[model samples]
Target: MKNDVFLKKFRQTIARYDLLEIPPAAGLGRGDKILVAVSGGPDSVALLYALLEIKDEFNLRLYVAHLNHKLRGRESDQDQKFVKNLASKLNLKFFSKSIDVKKEARKKKLSLEEAARLVRYRYLENLADRIKAQKIAMGHHADDQAETFLMRLLRGAGGSGLSGIPPKRGKIVRPLIEIKKEEIEKFLKQKGLSYRTDSSNLLPNYFRNKIRLLLLPQIKKNFNPKIVDVLNRASNIISLQQQYVEKNCEEILRLVCKSKRKNKIVLDLKRFIHYDISLKREMIRLCVKELVGDRFASLTTSSTELSFDSIERTLSLIQKEKSGRKVKLIGNTWAEVSGENLAIYSRKEKQYNYPISFPGKKNLRSLGMNIKSKIVSRPSLPQKIKSKGEEVAFLDWEKLKGQFRLRSRRPKDKFKPLGMQGTKSIADFLIDMKVPRYERDEVMLLTTKGKIAWILGHRIGDEFKVTDKTKKVLRIELIQKQK
Candidate 1:
């Protein structure tokens, strides 16, 4: 690979993905800060040099970041030192961090690779934020993409996993994604650049190593000589298809989604059940992606956390399990069949009990809702007011007895809904109304004299209904607060 060829390919990948542009119209073609993740290996070292060669053309301010996982003891330190020295030689800023990946793996109950990858990305992202970098560049190339595809394929991964490595994900960009590993090494040699080699990569202990050193070679020798190119081509096609699927999934998600919070998503089960199985699986993946605070592309290609079995279990919970049943998911998330809906939540649902003040507004933080209570005289009410939705209720004020409080439902709670004869259990009423079980705790109740006055946003109790004989009415309104 000639110097000009390597640079041309690098620029081409950037152009194809629009990598350097932050907002497309930002004219970020020049004077952009970039943080380059360098591991002192051949691929990363080549990437740094390649970017450095074109830095002036793009008017780029490049910074180098390295994480010493400390797995190889002295070798890890040497790797960090090499990266720092390279950055210094290039007259660029350098940042380095050391972490005991084995210790972190044990403490976090994760694999060594998982722990190291997580810590490395966190340090890079934080450093990038601190430096106000517009882009974080990685050295993932064609060979890595093919290996990733094979690994995921063997693990029974779906479309998302089979999509392979992306050229750009969020602020992370891979300029070498289209370049072959062999071409990268040739470029380094042609440029007389030296790079450190990790001994661990030669060992077949890790799954990736097994694929790179063992499986891939065997396939190339016995199967197709150009297996890497074949896999890469397939991944590119699948990636395009996956992007289209993701777009459609997002549109469908809007229809099925009932409520979306920072760490929770409630889906209407009645609407969800009507979708095809493929759509359902993709929707589940998208929900997990949102709950985990991941960019869609990042989760789709690189994440194996949401396994086929985990998604299947969630689907089973939605289809077969009784309402209120939940299945645990990755990243401290849970999927529960809540009556007429399915809820994916990262945090535990909490119960709220608070005092209600008349003629005042109260914010319910737990429910992300607000309650406004006011007393209105019947004579002052409009003659032909528009019919109110479930959020508004008119109750006879004279019938109210003890102190008023807004709280969640308790066990065996019963209320005589307006226009209904006898009392019905709160649980049964919620079921009959098709309210999700996860939302039951969030349903506010206006209670006085140890009796339910209204199921806020649902129904007003029979005892508190406004009538012709009533002179004053307790008007309560429920408002959903923006998260």
Candidate 2:
């Protein structure tokens, strides 16, 4: 009878939020073990108590993770103690990590707001992974969802951003995403349960707090009292559309970038030129990220929008002119038109190719190199030029820029090094290579661009090196790990 009452009340609440029609939990499989992130706030306390109340129904094994971002000093410590004591009362396993949030923020070069959230999520994610928990639940209620949606919307976030807080995101789930913050407070009051409030939440300093206390109250006063619910509905509708677009993006990636052998993603410009603007922008940006990760392309995401400017332009020319064209792109990769093959460099990697032809599945750190190759039957190349300082890959001869340029150091730089071999002093030969001593080795030799045009003590075999009669292509990969 107690379980029946709990279910009836829960169903009533779900219906009030119009979440009664929410899809079954069969997809997420909440499973038995659940990790909950508790901040001792009213919402979290309600979430914790509700989970405990319904544990038997869900067959749940719950663990609590908390982050002590020591920004409030003693007050923060008190919050931590308050949470620990409650966990003790509840007989729940409690995990806490004391971190200098300010220091971390500085070290990560992030704003305090961004860094705190980042560290908190990192700790929670690690806890979930370590415990092998399937869902990491949080206490974000509908009010929080509204704030996030408005914030992202103001920031010019597209549909993905407007989707707001999802009920489930990877291992992280907000089980109470449909619950209002005040209702949680009411639930706690009815049960005579007390919760600790982070005083900072009331301050106008943080954008979220300002939204919660100032903007939201103003909206309720001027417009409607149910603004949060209205925004929540808006976010849900946006989420549906966002999911469709995301699904299409995944398909686009699979189609255009499937054959890329290495971490680099090569775009087939022909196929890509056909996509509409929205998908084209996303596909192009994803291609850049897939090949080079986040560090490459564009200054700021907001200002730069998509990092596909160069690639998009190249595609435009290909579509507009129906001819061969080439453009240099961020992250030391190139988008090129050669014969019938329109390609985005799948091998945008830049690693030291000190010694080429290292065997497969290697950790050849000693060679100052990290590259890979699949030894298939030797495909005929347009030309065979060694890794001259200005050459990294065995590319088609026609692609070569026609002039061999090498970069390396020389004091009074004089050398009759190979090909231009003669008793030219280090000064004269370096002058010939037009490379400065400081940048001679680390100049990252390329065709005036930072591509792997050469590796010092190697060959400057060629650039845009493919020839007219070329038949096959050799794929080379480079890796420069940031993590």
Residue 182, model 2: lDDT of 72
Candidate 2 structure quality by residue, lDDT tens digits, 1-483: 333443355545435543312334534434358788888888888878877876765557789888999999998998899899999999999999999999997886766776787678778878888988867778888898899887767666766557777776556666577778777777787788988888888799977788888889999999999999999999999998977887789798777653453333445656766778788666655555555542331122222233335756866766675444556654355555544445555332344333233224434453333555342223443244454333345444334334433233324433334455334554454445644222232433323222333333333324433344555444444553321
TM-score of each: 0.76, 0.64
Query: Where is model 2 more than 4 Å wrong at Cα?
Result: 1-30, 258-263, 284-483
TM-score of candidate 1 against the unseen true structure: 0.76
**Tens-place lDDT digits, model 1, residues 1-483:** 358888899999988988875333333555678999999999999988888877766777899999999999999999999998998998988988899999998987778887777887778878888999988999999999999999999989888888888887767899999999998998988989999999999999998999999999999999998999999999999989999999999999999998898667988989999999999999988888887874334433233267888889889887785777877666567788876778987754566677776777877776778778889898888754342327888877889967988887887899887777899999888888887555665566778988988887888887777767889887878888755
Candidate 2 Cα RMSD (Å): 10.1
Global local distance difference test of model 1: 0.83
Residue pairs with backbone overlap in model 1: none
lDDT values of the candidates? 0.83, 0.61
Q: Which regions of candidate 1 fall more than 4 Å away from where they truly are?
A: 22-30, 295-304, 348-479
